[model samples]
Every structure is written in structure tokens, then in C-alpha cells.
Target: EDLIAIINQYGGAIPETYGVPVEEIQKGIKSGVRKVNIDTDNRLAITAAIREAAVKDPKNFDPRHFLKPSIKYMKQVCLDRYQQFGTAGQASTIKQIPLDEFAAKYASGELTAVAKKAVTA
Candidate 1:
């Protein structure tokens, strides 16, 4: 649907008016959702950037010309998403458990209950 701004494909294109609201996604993140899939948003940003670059210099046949801005726009979207989800800089807080240590913990039956609880919750 997003690509409708440029081209209409086989299934026909609709307006780019459908999406999960950012506030709703943020609410889910706050309510203990461990992960959020936001691939479409990122793709839209990248596509927009590419389209802008292509339109600005229609004869620019080099792929790099399109890719540079695409990377920048996608990076900004990722950063904004991270901030919105309150996950920015949270990677440093993650404790790295080694594979052997994790295996031992699981073998000792320590992780099974936690895994089951997570699944059922």
C-alpha cells in the first residue's frame, strides 16, 4: 500500500493510511511486550528516501545515490522506534549469559518453569 505513492502493483494500491498507531505500539511496549515487529515502517522510510533521491536526480543511475539517503532515513526511523519503545540504550543493561552457562541452567531445570510461564502468559 505504501508503494502506491509511486507505483500501483498487481493487487492494486490503496492509500497509505493504514498502520498500527505509534501510541498503541508504545502502550504495548510499556505493557511488557518483549518485542515489536516494525519492518513495514522501516521499509516505508527507506522507500520514501529512495524515491526522493531518485526524483531529485532522475538520471542518476548509480545505486549508491539512492542507498545513502535510504540508510540515513532508515537509521532515523530505527532510532525513533527505539526511543518510542523506551529501548534506547537498554542494550547495555542486558547481561550476557554464556552458552555453556545457559545450557547448564536449563539442564538443571531452572529455565523450564520460566520458559513455560512466558509461553502461557
Candidate 2:
């Protein structure tokens, strides 16, 4: 496949490889590619949504009328990507402490040392 050939040639340093189909995205993920950017597809979806919304409601001059559909379309695309990445049901597995508790610990200087090491590393 073209994707495999490119990965073989460039290893992990390829730049700006966008417009990959959904099946190729899975293949890339399986091939140890950690980051996948989908900004272009999301942008296209949002643009189409806004244009459709504007045409459907020609009387509405409010930006929210267009933005609502755009946001909805973008969110759906993101949710689809999450599912494709096999990470959709991971919310319950993430250990997230309360923001107030985290802030208290941070203010008490508990995370200062950890923060410095993290930043330096």
C-alpha cells in the first residue's frame, strides 16, 4: 500500500500527511504513529455546516445560528475520531482529581518539585 511504502521510506518524520481515509488511519495507528491531525477534515465539515445553515435560514443574521451547526458537526467528527482511535470509553478509566483539590495541593507547594522535574524533562 502507498501508506506502508511511505512509512517505510520516512520512518516517523513525515510532515503534513493529511486526507487519509478512515481505514488508513487505523493502519497508521497500528504502525506506531502516535499523533493524527484531522484539522482539515473538521474545517471542511464546519464550513459545509455553516454554509448549509446560512442558506437554510436566510433571515437569521445572528452568528449563533451558523455557529451552532458548525460546533455540532465538529463535535460529531471528533467523536467519530475518538471511536476510531479505540479511546471512546476511556473517560471512566482516567483518574482525574477535583480541580479544587489539585489547586490546594499546588498552592501548598506539593506539585512544585514535580512540576520543575516535568518541565525540565
Summarize candidate 2's per-residue lDDT along 82-106 as a digit string, tens digits. Answer: 9998778889998898999999999
Q: Cα RMSD to native, each candidate?
A: 5.3, 10.8
Show where candidate 1 strays beyond 4 Å.
Answer: 1-14, 96-121
Candidate 1 per-residue lDDT, tens place, 1-121, comes to: 2444642232334465677888998776666667798788777767777777777789999999999988987788889889888889989899999999999999998887442222322
Q: Each prediction's Cα lDDT score? A: 0.75, 0.70
State residue 61's C-alpha deviation in candidate 2, in Å. Answer: 0.9
Poorly placed runs, candidate 2 (over 4 Å)? 1-18, 95-121
Full-model lDDT, candidate 1: 0.75
TM-scores of all candidate predictions against the true structure = 0.68, 0.60
Worst 10 residues of 1 by lDDT: 112-121
Error of 2 at 79 (Å): 1.2
Looking at model 1, residue 42 earns an lDDT score of 78
